[model samples]
Target: MTEEPPIAVLTDDTAYAEAVQLAVDSAAAYYADGTSTLDDDAYDRLARGIQAYEEAHPEAVLATSPTGKVAGGAVVGDVPHTVPMLSLDNVFGAEQLADWATSLERRLGRPVAAWSVEPKLDGLAISARYRHGRLTQLVTRGDGTAGEDVSHAIGTIVGLPARLAEPVTIELRGEVLMTTEQFEVACLKRQAHDGTTFANPRSAAAGTLRAQDRPYVCELTFFGYGALPYPDDASEQAASLRELPHSEIMTWVAAQGVQTTAATPVAGIVAETLVQVQERIEQIATVRPELPFNIDGIVIKCDLAADQSQAGFGSRAPRWAIAYKLPATEKITKLIGVEWNTGRTGIIAPRAVLEPVELDGSIVTYATLHNASDIARRGLMLGDSVTVYKAGDVIPRVEAPVVHLRTGDERPIEIPQVCPSCGDGIDSSQERWRCVRGRSCRAIASITYATGRDQLDIEGLATSRIEQMLDAGLISDFADLFYLTREQVLGLERMGETSTNNLLAAIERTKAQPLSRVFCALGVRGTGRSMSRRIARHFGSMDAIRAADAEAIQAVEGIGPEKAPVVVAELVELAPLIDKLVAAGVTMTEPGWRPPAVPGIDVDPDAQTAPEAGGTSELPLAGMSVVVTGSMSGALEALTRNQMNELIERAGGKSSSSVSKKTSLLVAGENAGSKRAKAESLDVRIVGPEEFADLVGALL
Candidate 1:
């Protein structure tokens, strides 16, 4: 790779200063033409680099380093920042942070009187100004001086108040974010409408905010942080600030009618404050209900202005504060059912009904089954069981199913020869099927699945809404989500304008998602999280998947002997349907991975590898054949074990009705009888209680 001189450094040293000036000039050229001189990443990198270089070389780098001053003469036309906004210099890990804390103490000549720590919302930074408590203007954090005026956008957002409690004039800055529920729903809506998708809430919100349309911005939500007009000026004293309680301010802001982010109480010292911040972040997934929006991390600020003043400012933000982020949420669940719902695409989808499960604190009950072929090839039957999981807390799925049990009831299921919706037989082709109902039954599963922790994961679209959406016939399928006018959504008995806009904005933001996300959104059968990855890997493009023959498809990994034919049949049935989705403008594409494929397939990589050549890779579960009698619904059943041992290499665990010395994890159901006793006498490991989860995760 060609190396560019460290622009951040070069901008400071020996005559390179002149070059930095030239680049600044070039930046101005782009800024003047309604274009950005730097992409977000590059700009952030350059600005930080320049700041670092200046901080290091005082003689070579001037006091007015790029880091210290506002953007000079960039000539941005849209919105000018009334107050300069600066980015904070980050310090990672607690030790280094402690060092900084110590330094602050040395500077202060005493311990901090008090400090306030708040969550640093991961999102775009913007400022909103209100005159006499009414909204005035909205601007981005451009170069800290000039910004793109988004006053038009400010006018549309749902939560911000038109007037404050005190009728106070002020300018406030904070992160504008799409709530986790909002982001998921938006992703679902986009996947249904245009096949396009975004990576996360931040990207979804940012893209929507910057999109050309005003209605789109109105849908995205915004939150606020500290800016001006302290309800109690006395709240600023260092001693008092340490006592600066978060709940009071939050309550105060609400009363003032100003939107405020949820924050915690202030502690006496930075160390203690940081500890509190860590705890909150750790519990974020657990506390989603209380949070207004999704948070990637938190920001800690010294509540006392005196300490803040003593600490002074960094290149941009105050040294008194910093941001602490959390890791993304992930977990596993199980698939118990796949509900087939007709769509705009005549092809049917098997949406998974899961065991009551908690992932990232949210109770999950459904996943998409992908397509019909997936259902059959995976040997999935009405009674056969399967595993479920999530990629990120945002995307839940049914990864695989067990094919061993002949529950007799677990029989092969198929799409009706005639369409379920219109009861009219429609034609299918190489890549898709035609929906007899076309758009009529398309929305059948919308209220449930669409809101089922997948697409447009509406928190409250419960049992009632499913019936309501169907009764209203306001929508036929997912695409109709975007078409929903505010008036129509608000017309629903429980929904109002605020709620409707929240859902609609989520719909708009999802359109910008990269294509692969759209494919996952489809809920294809036999397409586990990993397989979706494989398909994306081999095809590398949506066109390829849509065009490949069954023979060609069986060629991919995770695409097994039985599945290949099903996959081809799946796409064939989906082709016409997808075409309709395309006409609607969905952005379907390959997933994240696009690795070159070896001809042979590698199904079930997660299954334990054989213990060397062929030494009976002894299943620790060996001799522990299990008979899951009765209701094992709450626990892993015989089917669950059969599926799990394939995961256990040695457990070579078997399922039987009668338990012997070979019985392990007896897994007695509600009516389990003699078999349970036989197993207990045989000293079999009877797995039960809530401990089932621990045993399951450890063994698997």
Candidate 2:
């Protein structure tokens, strides 16, 4: 059997101390960004090694080591948590778990009778507070002290309640996650739209929850693990639930219409002894693969709250509970070669060509090496054996090379002298090399961006067909797409008569697309759908934008002076391409394009005589900041809070998630809770669903 090497090893005490803090800080930063730079498996292994070293040399342990607390930082700003959101310490195997139980019994001077075992969800931790049965504030667990307010995205999460079955004030602690099915669907959609796909369901969930736009596309879910009391209302429910067992608490929460993991067979099981708890953890690990969402481990907690209180806490984690982490799905493979590829942005990334090995139910042939700097840090060589694992159980990554397996025959990998894809000299100014040929080097990626839905809305122009056209020399650029002959397209493989006509018809329909879409399809630097819409509406026609100078272009909303030069340069570079597109009968002007005056920024001095502005007839809710609370009734009963916010935005107003003194109007619906009270306290104008309908109309 091949010896499994340690994930991380440090020789010097000073170096080890620095590594501990580095791991903590890096983990926190990555969590905040909704992405991971280090694999969890490697992180866990390194953490365990640090802990063992600390045990042997207690004086050498650094105060900033990640062992004693939750492994993240307060990067996302939000309100301070009333109760500290603690993290659970891990026990890797059954023996360690049993030892922890034994130690706990010794500390308490009694035999631990019962424990509750639940799956530890591999997802973003969130605290959702409901006031008077209405969901009010949703926040991420940032550094266990404070969190980012994500209440705006609450309605988009499935299995997360908008309102409770009974009127109560409670804080539900859970994991915001995405299921395997949802993740696959989201990846497909992202691939189609030319958006970045997440490494795993956890990253996907985190990104979706924090995303500012199109969060609904990622379909997130929440699984409740625990609950607490809202600061002011703690006496009411906290008193009544203080002595309840952990399993019973979850059951009660589930019964109150809050989704919980209680339905899982292994969860909520009362284990009478340390042996029983270990058995339950094993049972959970066995069924982990079949679970809808990913679970990293099993959490074993004291069943009774009274006992939990006596258990106390360490610097970070509670002593009453322990997490038994499942072994990581990993495999050892040979590093065969390195392949450098250029992206649409011209940045070159290195991929590790590996000897194929089966891992986590799939065949792994290659993994991402990140960049040349990363390569140097890992000290990777061509023929060295390396450990490979899925970073988040989704993305394949080269963890590190096994130094003991290295021989003199291993060759040192170096940065490429030229671009592999375009045969051009590499730009070495940055750590990551890029093709000096720029956008021209990645024509396929550029064309992919142009045909995306948010761009030209070209139907049936997916990546595969574009690659086929490109490989066959039928099209060189996006402008060439419009000039493709029917016979040329038919010459490509799998181009049936119906498919050919469909492609041709799709290409023809794009000519009449709105100028905003056309501008976006041109792939101008730093310009997206929203920016394109703003510019097109500001100028009314593409010709005016093309003829405008940097100063004039920067005058448009959102476009800054720094970006103005790039926008003008790109437009100038593509001026010939734009001419060809226009000559091909593509629409050059947006129909009925009007730049709406910004609220507060562009004040109309017409004596406030606008009809829809509580004066004259036109734009409804103009210059108003409206807050919608609770759930609406009648025709708009089914409309989600996000949808209602969208409706308010579309009607020329700002939609706020929280009520404040700045709020111009508060739309209070059924069971209006904390926000409504705040609105009333501030003397903000309050309106019913009917009144709100009168303002924005009942169109949605």
Candidate 3:
């Protein structure tokens, strides 16, 4: 009989005095009932580690695995987007990007005389659909085809209004991102407590919106990324009902309490308009974070109705629109030495050792030195200062520092530098400087990345942790986390039931993360998050991803020989690790992973009983967006916290999270935070919950 593929690998260990089951159960509890169980930092680190394991062993990966999907509560039903949301095909360098514009022009049978460049936000896309001047549905952009109902989630948003002034139905689409200010505060918190912090704003925003709590949702903001335009004759279905210009329509949309895309119209894609889009991207770093949402790149689209229709969609994206994403953030420092490092695929490259410095918030000790020419471009020598920051469209690079900073201690790192392992000679013909014995290089890129901010970000699992685990026969590969025993964990200094359980619990929570994070944690050379997504879309299943060969992987945009071999090699080496993880009981399935169904409004419980409740309670807030402030008694808390939700629904009104111009009224309690201050500045209407209840009683 043919042997079935190996499934179980990890055996219960004698090393642990107490069963790990409790910790595992706690992790399950945390993910299942969020708000309890694991803290946010623990959860994040665990999630990232599980992702790494899945990436390595695509075949053994679980369907319920967290790879390639966003997490959320069980959505009651799905709703179709009014306008089908189409995602963009990204390009890193400017040349490939210019090629996109040229192709668009060629496809349209014209020389694209001019183009607009706009920031492409790094966030989730959403749609807010309204009908007859009343607030309606809010949905997540699930899979570009359909979305999940998130109206309850919408109630907590800072900017969106509960009701509109005009009696017209419309759908608006936009992006959600965190601003620089939010990032700083969040980073500070993480650093302060030795917690896992967010790598960037876009991912953080996406994570925030997925929470079940409306209060959490209030922390996220949405901005128009794209819109559905009506026909010039106003004959399209939505347009005929509302007679307004597209630009004016956007303004009306804002009036209804949604942030629309930023724009300054000119006489048809003129110099002034083009400059505005460019200027916006350049100034994004200076924008106020408190304004709500985030933007990373700019998107330029044909403004005129006729012009947009003429420029249509191709296979993947629209011909009418183009995005100008910022290149990776970069910085420079002097190169101390050229060090050879083996990455996931074991290819060796020179990494520049440098004096520690800060980037964004994290300290940087090294930069990918790349090749001999890159080293020469900056002119390197012993004691010569160098620059370090992201490279083209990337964060920080090391061009040698200002010549003035060079000191005797500085030395030129020889391209074809000595092999890091044996101090033997190296080999190179300009393209890549490599150690002849590549695998022996002392530097380890993948291991370093396993602990890096964007990948695993596992707390207490620093370079030191890795070395300890390595020496203790605890791990040699990324998947080993699944096999850790509680007893073995507690044996480590400072590790106890609480910390041990916390770490393992983190592991359980992350078992079902999306595929993008998986790809990222793999640290495949030159294949970062965006490219990983494309690979995921094509492969779909982990088994298929693992089975695919280099040529197939290389077919994706920007996947060249340099990156392809690295991925293929890494995949091959990950087989044993995958087997061990599965044996050890790491979940390999994509639990609760459902793509968006056809768009249709689900029966919101509040909406279903809304009419009757509206008449019975909250007479004062009948059909009004209300915000609450300060500490209060239990009754007031109920009224402001959840009761307001029911009352607003019953009265045919909706409750909003923050106070803004669109806010109908504020229910003040005591000890109000920024919301109170912001409300005063905006001059929004405010009232006490007691007064609100009285108003409701009188109205009812």
lDDT of each: 0.54, 0.76, 0.52
Best by TM-score: 2
Q: What's the count of clashing pairs in each model shown?
A: 52, 5, 83
TM-score, per-candidate, Cα-based: 0.41, 0.49, 0.35
lDDT by residue (tens digit), candidate 2, 165-281: 878888899988888788877766765564334455666677778888763366888889988875566474677776788888888899889888866544557888777776666
Candidate 2's C-alpha runs over 4 A off are 1-7, 53-63, 74-76, 214-216, 231-236, 330-700
Residue 272 displacement in candidate 3 (angstroms): 7.2
List the candidate 1 regions with Cα displacement exceeding 4 Å: 1-65, 69-84, 145-149, 179-218, 230-247, 263-273, 281-296, 325-700
Please give the distance, in angstroms, between residue 260's alpha carbon in candidate 1 and its true position after superposition.
3.5
Candidate 2, residue 170: how far the Cα is off, in Å? 0.4
Better of 2 and 3 by TM-score: 2
The order by descending lDDT is 2, 1, 3
lDDT, candidate 2, equals 0.76
Between prediction 1 and prediction 3, which has the larger lDDT?
A: 1
User: Which candidate has the top score in lDDT?
Assistant: 2
